[model samples]
Target: MESGTSSPQPPQSDLLDVFPQKGLEPGDIVVLVLYFLFVLAVGLWSTVKTKRDTVKGYFLAGGDMVWWPGLFSVLMLAWIFLPIYIAGQVDMYAGAIFIQQSLHLDLYLAIVGLLAITAVYTVAGGLAAVIYTDALQTLIMLIGALTLMGYSFAAVGGMEGLKEKYFLALASNRSENSSCGLPREDAFHIFRDPLTSDLPWPGVLFGMSIPSLWYWCTDQVIVQRTLAAKNLSHAKGGALMAAYLKVLPLFIMVFPGMVSRILFPDQVACADPEICRKICSNPSGCSDIAYPKLVLELLPTGLRGLMMAVMVAALMSSLTSIFNSASTIFTMDLWNHLRPRASEKELMIVGRVFVLLLVLVSILWIPVIQASQGGQLFIYIQSISSYLQPPVAVVFIMGCFWKRTNEKGAFWGLISGLLLGLVRLVLDFIYVEPRCDQPDERPVLVKSIHYLYFSMILSTVTLITVSTVSWFTEPPSKEMVSHLTWFTRHDPVVQKEQAPPAAPLSLALSQNGMPEASSSSRVQFEMVQENMSKTHSCDMTPKQSKVVKAILWLCGIQDKGKEELPARPEPVIVSLEENPLVKTLLDVNLIFCVSCAIFIWGYFA
Candidate 1:
């Protein structure tokens, strides 16, 4: 592990470790974290007095949210998906350069630039600012990723050419003793069997996707944005919108790896003995440098930076969100609970302290992260999250919808899942070991496809099994059941009898003016006259009268011989135009998004 002047240059070997780049210095990491803290402080400072009055104000920004800010939050949160995808690209691209020394510098620069922009906006406006910036950033990322794909496809001479080239590469690898090869199926072959294969189909389909769902759906960092929505409809709509965006990445991230293989067939060969020895001596030195190298060497300059920025933006988006959410959870969930009646000023101060502590912890952890080797960042994060998420999801879901799920069940289930997950992780570590000769050789824990699936299964089974067993042994309190049933049950339906005809305008006025009529009014309009005839408590209408009665009934009111419904009273409306703060936020976000889009596009271009 040579240091200082002895450090090798980029593209010298695909295995060159990126930690030695010195770009993201300890100070830089600290600065990044501090930037987040500052942003949070500013946000808190603006709302401290308001937030002190209610939990909702602190947690949800008072919820009278506008469309632009809400949209921004959704977009910023959605940006998380980019980093999770790009981390894999970095791994793959670095791997591609291992064969040929055609790695590029623009790609890394692009990533760095994107991170800078994200940090700036996040620092400028807190969550609100970050969200608006993210919406535009997300669009750029999608465009940049897709553009790369299109160019790569055309470079390889289309899908048919890609397949032909792949097969030819595979055939050549077989003859010359190479590790690269084409699969038996076409491009769309998604389901690979885990039992007899290197990559498992079932593992990805069931195991990986489930953890993803849990992460994207239940994880606090992601879900916090949805919670911030003004209403449930907005929250649901925002989430679904992000879900649709999720389906676009397969083509963007994975296809580039395949394209790299086709274009640089020779690099796909086994690592040269010399490079392999260097890598073995310091595995962390070059393990994740592959994808960045490919991007720098291959893409045109302007487009290169755009793609790199997209990747960097992705990373920053996740880091900032995690930092903010972690601070939030620590302050609201832990600190506030301990000091239940803490003052607004005190809580804000406590939140800042927690932010500083978390940042420091993360900084300390970064070195440990750099020291470790193997596994893609995305996979590593997801696998670890899988172990932690299931039980939390179970408890939260049950607590929200099922009142019968007592605090005891919630506590025990969470504990059971955590313990089970930890035990499974330990067991898996002990059982699985690589058979390579080198001292540093270890099984690829993060890259293992089923890791998330395995952790999630263990966590889920333990939680449900423990919770269910506890449920029957100590039945839920009767009060709990009553509360649960109250929320869950449907209201009873009742029938009503028809009355004789009245004046048209009178009937219309009655229907319109009595808009706040009791539940019985709805029932009265629905019951048919013929059905009422059986009781003989009300008079039956003639055949033509029945037709008129049916028409009135459908409108949820008696016709009363009305030709038209009367106009209802004018509804009261509130104006927010006089609110200077609201106007400022609107102006800021609009300018912010526009400026960000221009800068990102221009810088990338």
Candidate 2:
């Protein structure tokens, strides 16, 4: 009789089995992170005061934002979020062909390079520099994405032909007697089961989209830009721009996968063993590798380098943003709160030191991430973020909008969400093993989505429930309520001058005795008033006379009013010639825009 029990299962591969043997060279690793550090340092150098005194200055560059740099922030978002995500899809497709080559090395190194560039500017020039750099990065990334799409479409003999080829391939695979064939409407249906399906419509709509809102809305990296806006209008405009950019992912990520289905059908076939054994025993291994393999195989040298640079730029923008925000939180919330009276110079010193320490910690942790295998990188990063995010989002939203939430509730809710999410993650990791053998069986991806949704739901419920219970059980102090009231109110008087003059005087007297009167103070005060009067007189003379004359003229006494206006000393008039170069640049910009519009319209039509 055949053995009731099959042969003992193969020993499980190490969870870190995906790490490439070479790893990053020590020099390369240092250079990459250091480059990012240098960029951040440039931004940090622009910060002249302690973070406490210049919280807005440090975080938002005093809100004197420009449109171009704002555009960069938008671009940085794409650069940071899309490439790895798209690359992951490509790799999955390639894995179907059993390809051994992975973009792990490229991705890991690019991340390091990005970190280096972003860190230097962020640390030195602060948000201003980061924004400017982000703007440039954004343009580069857009061009790259568009170029990729154009090239991919042309290469695949246009979208229609590619779709036809894909369905034909799918049709060939259907069972002979079962009458199973690719549906004309859903030719791209790779996986079919609903409940067990990983990328089902339900997952995308219910699982991913809601979580993304919490992420993009409340996540420090993204929201930091909004907080830095010059006004509500700018903030809202920037957010809308980001939303528009988000819709570009379908063109950039999904279409590429479909393109690969036609261009590299063999890659998918080789993913299974029978094809691997029959056609080529040495399978390429996975479909995820399809993207990089296509890049390496098809794209020319210059374009390849350009695309690679775009990817690196994206990674850098995100890494720098994360590093900066993390450092800001640690230095301000933890360090400064502990040492509230620290001097500006001393705090700046502490900030720099904190940045260094955080970089070291991130470097150490990044290796662990690099070594992780058998899942999409974007999904993995986002899933982890979701677990930590919901509680923070909940507390912040509640604290911002609700009056009853106390600090205790916020703290406990965050802790509870993190603990529960982590417990679920650990259980899933242990019990629901990563199905590395079956490329189509995306256990990690499905589990991650499940974990994120459940974690968010539980986190939201816990935060509201705990905050409500805590509010009633241990009510917030009157002082805390007053503070919350001050933050919420839009009244200028309440915001600018909450305490009366007497209160300030009393507090000042308690700290130090009133200063003795001095002759120098009197002289300085008089001089300041004289200068103010002169400036005010200069501004009002012409406008005041014009208004008076107009009123008198309406009453038929214009000549009499003009005579009374004491001969306003002939207003100093200075005329300056426009720079020829400035005019040339404007003309050139107009021409470029028109040309671009014409070209696009003609091509599309």
Candidate 3:
């Protein structure tokens, strides 16, 4: 890699011409190929080994996964919600795309291939495959990320050197007397000036917590991972371990990003719109390319491919969790609402199809992601989330904690808050940020107020709306609040009389409008229901062709045409009990974890 030159250059010289372009070597290609094959192997193994014949098996991994894998799986998906872990996973997908563009790889090919490979296992094996593959990805990501972090720190001569050099990384042609293309004055601080800094102290303390609460507590993606745990103990263990893992990204991603800016300030910190456009095809700024630029220019051939694999792992981990959760939400919530009598098999098919459709739609949104928030992907994500998520978060929080929060209040509050946020969102799109050093032309609400502050305002308004509506509306039924609110979670479930199990459609049709069950008919129905209760190794019809059977096996589906509906079992009591010793250990660890987190924030502040 060439050192940064301070020598003067022609004003019109293309940035592309200024720096020599590099592509993946043969060894890099080999490593990347091996990584892909390994991922597919893991996916295939999970698909065959894991049970996925029922909704619980497919969507929640049968609630059987142990703590260790669940820990890594949660780390892969949930890291983005926490402030300290925010920069790590966001960099993965965005960094991967930037790396492809940097290497002059075919962008469309890369996107399609990545999404297709992810969709294959995700659609076929469901959440079990996602969790299994995520555990593997977590390992690869740690290795590759730590490897780069080591190389990065060495290149920068350690933390002391980084602090000295990062501030010096400024674009040569940056306009005098302007902050454009310069490192932030509070770059090293967590708590910054409330009014002027990119991340304000008050907003970080108050506003950021709203979305974080929503993500950790209510978001389907994060909750689904915990739902796969075997017991409360395993769930606690996984969550605690994931919390510990959060400390790694500060070293792995944040420091390396700073190192990239220091090492290649000319490219990563380019201020000239024309120069950035020529380099990354985005004139906003090339800061988003920091990590990718580091991987390409700083690493050896094989290691370069390993980091590529890491990026791929990160991308797949994030995407699979999202795809699985979205599928679950759509199938169980929307589809079930529309078709109450839809069979489990039909739900399964619908969920898988939804994933496929999501992939296709996601591909179409790539351009918008690439261009948003001055080409900084993480900022775009947070800003958009602020615009939409705070309201939903408020509703969830209120519904859980406040017994008085009726359905009408929650609904109207959410609608009102979302409308306000949506207006801000539309205005933001219509009046995009101007290029650095250009005039500020956006509205006062858009330009003067920060997104995080806007989130705080949104949340307050939502709380007000919910409270006002609930005060005037009729109180909710006791049954509705029982065992549902946080205060009532420990209350006993109000059991209702068990309804007789419905007969399978095939059996019902065969009976031919028998209005009353004679003793003989009841006996036959009981026998059929008993038979349906047990699991069978193979449920497909012998008459089906070998080809069709093979496809069904691959998809983890039974031949529903010949299958009998299983009798619904009586609900069992869920024991929240844990081994006293394990509980003590976890409780101790939680205190330690929280302490460490607080120390880091204060030290950084």
Say which candidate scores most in lDDT: 3
Cα-lDDT of candidate 1: 0.47
The residue-by-residue lDDT of candidate 1 on 1-605, one tens digit each, is: 55567422212223333222213334434534454455445443443223222334444445544443343233322211112222322333332222122222343443343334333433223344444444555766788778888887777777766656654433122323544233445344555556645335666555665555556655566766766666544554465456446556656776666665555433332234333334322322232433443455466655665555555446555655654555557677778899865544355545545544544454344433333323234444555555655666566556545656766676778778778777655644454433232343435543342565565576567558556855776667654454234353332322334342323333343433333334455335423332533444323334347667653332123323222233333332322123466446545655665575455435423
When 2 and 3 are scored with TM-score, the better candidate is 3
Q: Residue-wise lDDT of candidate 3 within 43-159, one digit each (tens)?
A: 888888888987888998887988888854332222112121222234334744654654565666777778878888898888889988999999999999999999998987788
Candidate 1 residues lying further than 4 Å off, grouped into runs, are: 1-59, 66-124, 167-188, 265-290, 370-375, 396-403, 427-453, 476-605
Per-residue C-alpha lDDT of model 2 across residues 154-208, encoded as one tens digit per residue: 7766777566555543312324454222223444553334454444444444445
- All models, RMSD in angstroms: 20.5, 17.0, 5.1
Which residues of candidate 3, in runs, are more than 4 Å off?
A: 1-20, 72-96, 503-543, 560-567
Better of 2 and 3 by lDDT: 3
Better of 1 and 2 by TM-score: 2
How does each model score on TM-score?
0.59, 0.61, 0.89
Model 2 lDDT on a 0 to 1 scale: 0.49
Which of the predicted structures, 1 or 3, would earn the higher TM-score when compared with the native?
3
> Sort by TM-score, best first: what order?
3, 2, 1
Candidate 2, superposed: residue stretches over 4 Å from native: 1-56, 72-114, 167-194, 200-203, 265-287, 371-373, 436-449, 467-471, 474-605
